[model samples]
Target: MFAIERLNKIKELLLAQKRVDVYELSEKFSVTEVTIRRDLDKLEQKGFLVKTYGGAVLNDKLNSLPNASSGDTEQKFVEEKRMIGKIAAQMIEDGEAVFLSAGSTCLEIARNIKGKKITVLTNDLAIGLELKDAPGVKTIVIGGDLIPLSTMLVGGFALQMLKGIYVNKAFLGVKGAQLDSGYTVSHYEEAMILQEVARISSEIIIVADYSKFNVKGFARLGDLTMAKKVITNTQLPNEYKKYYFEQAVKLFTTFDFR
Candidate 1:
């Protein structure tokens, strides 16, 4: 594997498991101990992790904030997320009604949605707050019990509120996206709300970084078939590309821009 890909795997491993052993990673990636140490040093310098005795851990600053905080999650995959957000935002037209889901990736899309005359509906409080001040963009929040971690409304109330409204596009984020488990979320309440959003939208676009792929979460929201398009960073594997394509879901990656 390429050095960049190996480094990303190490990051993902640290994020998922809070800690990683250098020897284990060295064996997994088929790299020498010296090379692994060099990789760890590089990641530490980038502020993505902290070097431990025999491994590395995710930076504490990145872990301290709630997952709902766009500021925190934005630091995880800066460039790739921005590129995906830009492309997803481009798919939206001036007058379209769009639903921005609650997550870091959706927040990025909200940031770039300026100057568009569009009706925006979301269950994400952060997205509402960000777009509330933008002129000519009507923002609607689906009211329900607020979940602080994701800053999203959940429960039957939020689902009931979205019963009849159909959006041109719905941009969603996933905790995990796998071939077997499909799109999943770590929390059950959030999954319920996302399921409703998926059902009501005319087209669903899942905005996720490549790290989300191959991971399985606690709750399964829906399959790739539910989404009309999957927008992610270029690091998505060829296996995923083939799987999504065979499932008839259009997969769009940001590398196309470069």
Candidate 2:
């Protein structure tokens, strides 16, 4: 294929996948890695993509990709998150303090709870705002540097605040969950605060949809073993059931819970 045709194909892939690595592109196009890098450079210069360490991501100006914790992300896995959220909220006992991590799934958990007198500590600005009218639920925000994309407060300030309190459970979210890296998120600062939240909580429960499986992120929060339980949709593949059992992590699926 011609150079122009290959470059156009790469752009199409980026639009669909949001990100792509040089190695994969090279193999897919039957070209050298150096050739792929040159194509990426051209794309970046044209303001179509932003080149990362070994990959390229869609440029914000060119693609209106939704924020990670925004409504769009919420809608992507609506039914799955709703099921996981309800099951996760059920894990909380009445009047128990809990840490609700920032994400679409975590927000669903917050929305599903009713008539529960609980103290909710969260770094998500949206979660804190939603709990204001939750009747019987007291919401506290962990103040720090706010990340606009995810609406999460990270950095040292948030970490210190979380350390001062212990909760019954922490319902955490992640960009991906892989057998090797466990739970992972996109940003390093976010991962740091999430790690601390998991540390202080007695039970670390990961609430994710089936889509998150096998996807790896830029930063890993902790190993899968850190989770006491995992709440997911009924669609969780059967192949992963044995892994969760071996890790001694309890799995709650909508199939059984819902």
Measured by TM-score, the strongest candidate is: 2
lDDT of 1 by residue, 42-133 (tens): 98998878887777777888767466223444355666887888999899999999999887688889888878999999888989999989
lDDT of candidate 2 over 1-258, digit per residue (tens) = 999989877876565446777866775577899999999999999888899887888888766845432244334456667778888888888889999988878988999775799999999998988888988998999999986434789998888887668998898998778888788886789899988887788888988888778767667888888887998876777767888988788988888654
As a whole number from 0 to 100, the lDDT of residue 235 in candidate 2 is 73
Candidate 2 positional error at 119, Å: 0.3
Model 1, residue 58: what's the lDDT?
77
Q: Per-model C-alpha lDDT, please? A: 0.81, 0.81
Candidate 2: residue 32 Cα off by (Å):
12
Runs in model 1 deviating more than 4 A are: 1-76
